[model samples]
Target: MAVSPAAAADTDRAGTGDQRPRSRRSGRRRTALAFWAFTGPFLAGLAVFTVVPVAWSAYLSFFDATNTVTPLSEDFVGFGNYTRMLQDQAFLDSLVTFSVFAAFIVPLTFACSLGLALLLDRVRFARAFFRSVFFLPFACSYVVASLVWKMSIFNGVRYGLANAVLDLFGVDDVAWLFNPDPPWYWLVIVSLRLWIQCGFYMILFIAALQQIPAHLYEAAYVDGAKPGRQTFWHITLPQLRATSVAVVMLILIAAYQAFDEFVNLIGNQAYARPPLVYLYYTALGTQQDLGRGSAGALILALIIAIVTLLQGRLLGFGNKEGR
Candidate 1:
């Protein structure tokens, strides 16, 4: 009752086919394991450097920790820090100031970036040159830029470039940083941020705009659509939706975490301190109130989270329109 040759051949082919799939599955599993093994170090490092520090900071926010030689010597005062933060007038002022700064900086940066990106997108000659020129500021160190603005541009009445220009126009010397007025100082700070940041965002928008199909614009032109209306309805707004979200989020976070500019332009000398700057001064300066500083940092983080959620909701709403 031996099997025929044809039947034996069929059995062999079937066995090989079955083993092929199993071999593929085993290889895939090995590949996955190897990938995880390679990345395990990075994941561990991230936990140690990023996650642990965040958890520690949150935990320390509950204590009356100080920068003194003995951090453990400070008493554990649960929620006392938060309570004082609620009562602190300066903390409240910083919140308002930061809010105002975000309100102005975000829109200004996005609008200017979009405009510049559009302008650059239309240019044909030396486009790379213009892009490099615009984006150069983003590559510059924030501290150096801040110092330059403080000394060279907004220095003071006697030696600042801005004041020199004002003098030519018969305007008197103005206190750029010293002024505590409602909008003037904020405006100047926001302007400097926009100047530095708009270029980076412009490049982002330019990249997005380039991804859009050129044929769509040509088709619209063939159908008698004007450049302005076509761009508004078809090319510009729709293509930029995701990019706009990213840019807004970045600008929002940067605005909330603003420290270097305030530190360099106005120093920790009391007059012009944003929230983070104030927090740094509080945690390290005279009072050495680590609890208050932690509370401020936590509050700022919460505000950013809430705003990000709101923006996400708005983006969802916008995407619902078939974008």
Candidate 2:
């Protein structure tokens, strides 16, 4: 339709204004799509694999769903599993064993890793070589390492490496894994854990150690703080405090979850079973009780959470510096 010049100009301007908003809307839509494209897969997998499983486990803990074919047919038992767990003597004993192992391994690994890191940090000759050497054991599979400790080192025979070393000292072969008098199985268990994990923690500490400011050490030296234990105490340790806290937390969590080594080395024996091992036996080993297993798992999780919170409170984790 042929219109006046002024009307045509106004019409053109109105059309341009509408087009601007449409273009902006299209741009925003594309941005939203791109965001989903990048993050959708990961979020979906997390929900399906982790979130769903945890939620289902929580739900399962309240039911008597053991040996059932389907959830619909399962019986609901409210707090029955929790009450039963308290009365299970073997379960209680497993907690005690876990506690003792934690007491030994946590401190031992922390000290050994820190010491190795301190030494390695100062090494100028073949620094990478030394790091790789120590870290090599960590790269090996836990099952493999456990097997090596069980069969090769502490075989409880005259030909075992441990016995060979003892022979050098004129000591007879000892049944390290079987002897219950002093609980010598601990030697095999503890050494295997330390050897496999110490290097990884050493790497962590080494990285933390490297991040410390050289000027701090220099200032310490200038203040008549000689290169001694005092410098390490005042400067190095203070700088590595955060890393140390994290390492200790990891050690505690790992200790509580100690199952692979215990199972591989000692089987399902009462002497070395941790909470997870005991739960495993309860759930699938002969009993086939998934409900009780889930309950025990949740309990263990609670223990871990409480211990973590206590450690965090004591160490002031997540606190801002100076606060």
Candidate 3:
């Protein structure tokens, strides 16, 4: 076989070219498989836990789905559950209570968090220690904290911390949770929330504050701005618009989901019932009306979405241009 050098080179080139494409295809296949392997479980969990439940709840909301979860069993009273919950006195009162709590907690938390963050930002010593100390309460659960507040701090006895303090000024023991005449329970709940929330948000604000360029403050001072109020209003606050909006949105959603503390503190009392507590008693309490509960849940979800979107619109949340 008298093969020319040129023919041998062409055959070699063809063989190399074939192997290259096959190797490339093998690498691509491996990469695709690895990605799926990593993400498949997460996707499955999302479908099972989040998607299926929401769809099922939506389906159940439209039916008289009482006592059983089997789908569409001849008790399909269309929109009956939704309308009934809308007219429910307890549900309506719960909405008002949520509004009141949000009104107080959101601004108060924002202020307290910002204040703590600013103080910590200015500190050059023991900053981490103070931050941890402030953040420690957040690790405690709502139920436990509510019990502490109810039984120890504001227990309406002379031995209680709050009442002990009041006793110093010749005041009698105050019924913090029991007395609805003055609604002193708000102080306990608000303070507990502040203790839990401020540290976390304070950490957030501190991060945001650290990101602010020092030159901005320097330039403000150069432009006849004072250090205390003037610099904060002009340079500090405007720079923190994104963080502020996010904190407000989070606080709003948390307020809407208020349940654990209220339930543990008051035990299904109608005096200051949040929507979740009210819905819980309706769905799982003595009545056990699942249909109305599902409807209420959807309505609450709608309200939350609407309010969040409105905040985003009004405050330019997620708007990069404004930022």
- For this target, which candidate reaches the highest lDDT against the unseen true structure? 3
How do the residues 202-313 of candidate 3 rate in per-residue lDDT, one tens digit apiece? 9999999999999988888888788999888888898898989889998888888889888888878878899999889887878778888889999998998998889889
- After superposing candidate 1, which stretches have Cα over 4 Å from the reference? 1-33, 68-74, 269-271, 317-322
RMSD of each: 8.8, 9.4, 9.3
The models' CA-based lDDT, in order, is 0.77, 0.85, 0.86
Better of 1 and 2 by lDDT: 2
Model 3: residues with Cα > 4 Å off, grouped in runs: 1-31
**Which 10-residue window in model 3 sums to the lowest lDDT?**
1-10
Residue pairs in clash, model 1: none
In terms of TM-score, how similar is model 2 to the real structure? 0.87
lDDT of 2 by residue, 206-264 (tens): 99999889998899888999886999998888888888888998888888778899888
Task: For model 2, give the RMSD to the true fold.
Answer: 9.4
Candidate 1, 79-194: lDDT as tens digits: 88888887887877777777777788888999999999989998989999999999989987778888788778886666789899999989888778877753356656777888
Clashing pairs in 3: none
Candidate 2 local distance difference test against the native: 0.85
For all predicted structures, in order, the TM-scores are: 0.84, 0.87, 0.89
Each candidate's clash count: 0, 0, 0
Compute the lDDT of residue 279 as modeled in candidate 2: 91
Task: Give model 3's TM-score versus the native structure.
Answer: 0.89
